[model samples]
Structure formats: C-alpha cells, structure tokens
Target: MILYIKYMVSLRCKILVKDELIKLGLHYVIVDLGTVEILENITQQQHDELKKSLLKSGLELLDDKKSILIEKIKAVIIEMVHYAEELPVTNYSNYISDKLGYDYTYLSNTFSEVKGVNIQQFIILHKIEKVKELLLYDDLNLTEIAYKLHYSSVSHLSNQFKKITGLSPSYFKKIKMKRSGNLENT
Candidate 1:
C-alpha cells in the first residue's frame, strides 16, 4: 500500500513517519519525501489510527487524487531545489513538465489554483531558501552559488535574491540571521 503524506518536507519528517509506521506495527518498504510504500495493506482501523497520529504531528495522509498530485508536484520541486546538486540549463517549466509527464500550462494552472502561488514563484522561493543555505555553509562564493542554482549570472542571482528577500545576498550573509523558506509550503 502506498500512502501520500502532506507536509512531509525534511529528513526529520522521513524519520518521524518511519517511527510512526513502526509504532503502528506497519512494515514499510520505503519512505521518501512525501510518500510511503508499505509492505502490507492496512486495515481501516489501522489507517484511521495512523491518520490521527500523523495529524497530531502536523502531517496528513492524503487520500484524494488531486491532493496526491499536488503533493507530487511539491515533492519534485522540493527535491530539485533542496537536494539536487544541480539544475538543468533549460527553463524550470519545461523541466518540470518533462519530469511530471504533463503539460506545463496545465500543471502550472493547477498548482496556482490549489496553492495560491504560481509554480515559478514557488521555485523562486525554494531557490532563495537554497541560496540562504549555501550562504550559511560558507563553502561557496556568490558566483558559484549562482551557477549551482542555474542562475544566468551572479548579478541575476543577487537581483532575484534581493527582490525576494529585500536584502542583497552579501548583506544577508553578513547579517547572519536564520533565514528560511515559506513555512506553509516548506
């Protein structure tokens, strides 16, 4: 049985889901960013109990097809932004459409209708958060960060970063404040 979980974003979230499955005596084959594959099908009682437990921790087991699709979109975007070492030179719309096997326009429209933000805006938000992470690590220069995140140039990266964050990348790094992504989505 496969279960889609909404709001499971981090490695810690994966751990929490795994622990919950174990506590419920459910054997899971795999637990990825936003979904879990169980070795055996679950009973209604077990499913209800799991749902309640997950809700307490701010996670919800997605049952609707549309919600599941939205979660898949979120998972792919999150993975690309946070975990991938590099992004393609092509535009993100083409990349995402090819990856998800759907028309870019359809996906973007659905995402915006469901999430109240355009896909590009979401990508920018995630990319900005990635920039914040790299800056905090102090292992890469602005140029390198721009390249890794697929920005055209350091200036472009800085421009977008400032537009989104209201602070230049250098200024942000100097301030050393704990920066983060969109809380509702991330």
Candidate 2:
C-alpha cells in the first residue's frame, strides 16, 4: 500500500516515519518525501495506530486524492528549492510540470486553491526562506546566494528578499536575528 503523508518534507521526517513504521511492526519498501510504499497491506487497526503515532509527531496520513495531490506539489517544490544541490536550467514551471505530469496552469490553480496562495507566491516565500538560511550560514555573499538560488541578479534577489522579509539581504545577514517562517514552520 502507498500512503501519502503531510509535512514529510525533510530527511529527519523520513527517518522519523521509518522509525514509527518499524515500531508498529509494519514493513515499508520505501519512505520518501510525502509518500510511503509498504510491503504488506495495512489493517484498520494498524492504520489507526499509525495515524495516532504520526499525529503525535505532527504528521498526518492523507486519504483524499485532492489533498494528496496538493501535498505532492508542495513536496516537489520543496525538494527542488531546498534539497537539490543545483537549480535546473529549464524554467521552474516546465520542470515542475514535467516532473508531476500535469499542466502548469492546472497545477498552479490547484496549488493556489488549496494553499491559499499562488504558486509564484509560494516559490517566493520558499526562496526567501532559503536566502535566510544561506545568510545565517555566513558562507556565501549576496552574489553567490543569488546565483545559488537562481536569481537573475543580486539586486533582484535583494529586492524580493526585502519585499518578503522587510530586510535587505545584507542587513538580514548582519542582524542574524530570528526571522519568521524558517524551516520549522515551512
């Protein structure tokens, strides 16, 4: 059985889900991002138990198709922005559309409807979060960060970062204070 889960966006989340499955004596073939493939069919009892366990850890199993699709879209975006070592050469819309096998308009509309924000808004939000992470690390300059995040130019990145975060990239890096919406919230 394949189970789609919400808020399973990080390596630590994957590990936690794997541990929970093992503790429940369930065998899973794979656990990735938002979905898990299990070796054995699950019983209602196991499902309920797993749900309760996952809930305690702030994760939920998705039963509805629409909700699952939304999570899949979010997962794909999150993976591309955060986990991938480098950005793709193609435009994000094309890359995401090809990856998810859905039209860009449909995916964007669905994502916006479910997430209460447009896809571009979500991408900007996430990119800003990435900039915060990079800035805090103090390992990259504005230009490098801009290039790493695939911004057209440092000025463009700074403008967007300031618009979303209310602080310029340079000021943000210098302050090193807690900005809202980091990895924990996202």
Best of the candidates, TM-score = 2
lDDT of each: 0.88, 0.87
Q: Could you tell me every candidate's TM-score relative to the true structure? A: 0.87, 0.88
TM-score of 1: 0.87
lDDT tens digits by residue: candidate 1, 1-186: 899988657778888888889999999998987889999999999999999999988889989887887888888898888888678677888888988899999899899999999999999999999999999885999999998998889999999999999999999987774343344346
Task: Give residue 10's lDDT in candidate 2 (0 to 100).
Answer: 74
Clash counts for the predictions, in order = 0, 0
Q: Per-residue lDDT of 1-186 in model 2, one digit per residue for the tens?
A: 899888657778998899899999999998988899999999999999989999999999888888998888888888888889997789989998999899999999898888899878888888899889988865888899999989999999989998998988878876665454354467
**Candidate 2 at 56: error in angstroms?**
2.1
Residue 169 deviation, candidate 2, in Å?
A: 0.8
Highest-scoring model, lDDT:
1
- Which ten-residue region of model 2 has the weakest summed lDDT? 175-184
